[model samples]
Target: MSYQSIHIQIKEMIFSKDVSIVEFQFWLAEVETFLCQQQNFVLVVRSVAGTTFPQEYRQIQANWYKKNKANFFKYCVGLVRIALDQVDQERLNTPALHVAWQVPYYVTLDRADALQWAVQRWLLCNA
Candidate 1:
């Protein structure tokens, strides 16, 4: 499934470029729908190079996670982010973001490493 800058394939979601608030909201809605399905799944987010979002995006995402904390903890096995650089990775791995994530969160500059970690987490959670 593809929506604007967001693309979903199997258990992974890729953000190929910057997105508008409308696109961000739509992606959040998709995430909410996915969580509602009550299936254990690893969420891998790939942020391609040069992709960035406004501060409003963070606030909106944090709010969404706060509202869905219970369902996230119940269904999301782990969260893996494939960042473009160390700065991007660090930004996502901060304490404030951790509070919203709650689940095991891993951030890396390597897409292969991110997918490997996500798959391991998913298998472990299911096992």
Candidate 2:
């Protein structure tokens, strides 16, 4: 699947809302350049919001993320403030560890905190 390139200025870490796998793929294609060129990254998902992806699809993507864990150095995660169903929370919580349970990483339930944490960490990483 192909998606129109989404342009986002990530000079400072910021929270991104739910995006599809193809859009995620497109975003990653963009992020790879940053990861290779910059210090680190912190990406946040506000919530599932909506999706056409099946459960298996998300699981597969999450699995790929888990396998490529080492590809990340500067990354963190934040969940949305909106309420989520049990299944959605489970899905988010599981892959979130790819961000949460790590060295020099953190998980914030609030978007503002997550962005602040990510920016601080990025500054520290560069310093």
Return the top candidate by TM-score: 1
Q: Per-residue alpha-carbon lDDT of model 2 for 81-102, expressed as tens digits?
A: 2224555545545556544545
Provide the lDDT at 125 for model 1. Answer: 69
**Worst lDDT 10-window in candidate 2:** 75-84
Mark the regions of model 2 whose C-alpha exceeds 4 Å error after superposition: 1-20, 51-56, 59-68, 74-103
Q: Model 2 has how many clashing residue pairs?
A: 1
User: Per-prediction TM-score, please?
Assistant: 0.77, 0.51
TM-score of 1: 0.77
At residue 64, candidate 1 shows an lDDT of 92
| Backbone clash count for every predicted candidate, in the order shown | 0, 1
